[model samples]
Target: MTNGSPSESAISPGKPGQSTAVHVRDVTMDFGNGALAVSNASFELETGKFLTILGPSGSGKTTLLRMIAGFETPTSGEITVNGKPVDSAPPHRRSIGMVFQKLALFPHMTAAENIAFPLKMRRFNPKTIPGRVDEFLDLVKLGGYGNRRINELSGGQQQRVAIARALVFKPELLLLDEPLAALDVKLREEMQLEFRRIQHELGVTTINVTHDQREALVVSDDIIVMDGGRIQQHAKPVDLYRAPDNAFVAGFLGVASFINGHAVPGGLASGENFLSGTHAGDFADGTAVRGAVRAEQIRIAAEGGQLTACDTRLTGTVRDTIFEGERQLYVVATEEIPGITFRIYHHDPESFGLFEIGTRVMIGWNARDMKIFESRAS
Candidate 1:
């Protein structure tokens, strides 16, 4: 993932009297006696906060979302919404609204009709539906566009209509399954901000599932990173990015470089270097381990320093450089660790002016920045 910093908006905690919006406990689902689709997933989402399930394809994020929306049943476990157990609740009766990836708006209906569909289904009086429709259309910033057909509106406008329709009934919880995936990159980003704004205004608890890590980080109050049907880490976006619990979480969240080493008597031993750092847990001396470091934590040296002769120093030849607008990325390869590369972010190129290909350079990170993960037996 790119390491550039993005704009962050403040997240609001739920209101004082709001109840727990959704409680998932020991939720596990399997398919045809095969591998688990979701395993022992548990979390409580307070009312009015937006939570995101972030994972790659086949990671069970969509399945978990579907279960919460009552489209799929868990093989075992319990789900409660507003303190009421809902494992057997039907989709329409759960008081949850959903916006699907395809928008699913009826092409023939006007935006007002689409927004009123849910209220109409509940046999709301025809007189009441129009007022509620207008209220939601205005809430989503599409009050004047409600008379237009779904086909006439732009993609972003259509998305707004879909969201208005989902929320018109004032459901207790909202589920968004990749609602912005089909839009262009620029529109997708704009809609992320818009979605957050709407969530705040409506004060509805929301759960979104998406594969885009950047999107998750931008809009979610908390992120649940999943892999192979189990949650790898659950925390605020910044915490997950900075201090992932394991190698998978570290590698999946953002750009990271791993240093394979063993804890020796003095420090960590890898190739010709021995570096010192805090370990996650107690391990025997000479125990195999892997150290993780973020690209931004590494510093490039021009002349000489203590790292030059220590185990923390990694001498490599610059192999490639990528110039982003504000920062440059250097990919360096060392003889001691052939095929392994380190990525360093340079803010001021003139400080250590751009290095040409094949220029030998040494890179090092602070001992405190290193994270050691115990190597598992293969």
Candidate 2:
């Protein structure tokens, strides 16, 4: 939105005392091309909470974010900010702050000037703008570097400036559209923590959209997983990891290995081995089903004995061993499950090359670690 002709209010346009910061109700976006970009999406963000919408490309995460940002109007639903509908409100007219992948700082403007731009555009008290700029500069930890031009600053510093600019006016809701996508791995991880720090410090309700699962897990109080224009699951990070509602969510959120099988008397039957595990719904005998077990939950045992009181056991040949600094990954192929290969993590920092390739090892996991879900194919 153009900075000109926007609202002049410094505080959030949203009414106060409402627990929800943003409310999206049965929102859908159809671009008139016979395909819906977002389908019947609904969620609520509490005051001062951090949420991330995570999915791969074409999953409609960005489209969902754009709808909330007032850039695109939903075809079938209403969006409310602090309990008021903002479907017809212009972007700038809403009390929301946004940071995108591109920093979008004016090259000719200094950092301090960049922070003050929003204040000037919103027509804040001219005398108070300078102090406000300094306050935000310090808030983002760029206190003394405000005089540097955009080109003179480092990439991370430029990011800090962008954040300062967005938060200088203290908009109640913050939208981050993959703001850290351009940084290197180390810097991106650092900024993820920085984002959490700043959000906790200010208690500004935030919603971020990204394809990065680690970022979503690291910085969000809650997460919504989307696929094929639909929301698959929405839950807190730990619960989303520990207990996924469906197979797609289980495979997407963690390193889970899959074994296709059919439902039996009490569990699932894959090849010659009987599997036992947790499941959300009832599965009739002879129904098509698939079992999932996380990498961390599987452990390597001795050839004749089990590891740590596991209920389900299997003997497999170690096919590949991968070292990843803090942990070792052992890939096992068991004859009992002909087509399925299991990846197990050994987080013992000192256990480098603990198992050699071409070695026979017994791997086992507790019954609870293996989750059974109805086959998506069925």
Best by TM-score: 2
- Off-target runs (Cα >4 Å) in candidate 1 are 1-18, 264-267, 303-311, 348-352, 376-378
User: Which candidate has the highest lDDT of all?
Assistant: 2
Worst 10 residues of 1 by lDDT: 1-10
Q: Write the per-residue lDDT of candidate 2 for residues 71-153, one digit (tens) a residue.
A: 88899998887877875567777778889879788999999999999999989989888777877888788989889999999
Mark the regions of model 2 whose C-alpha exceeds 4 Å error after superposition: 1-18, 349-353
Q: What's the lDDT for residue 38 in model 2?
A: 94
lDDT of 1 by residue, 208-290 (tens): 99988889999999899999999988999999887777777777876778878898754577876776655766789889988
- The alpha-carbon deviation from the true structure for residue 334 of candidate 1, after best TM-score superposition, in angstroms, is 1.9
For model 2, state the Cα shift of residue 273 in Å: 2.0
lDDT of 2 at 12: 48
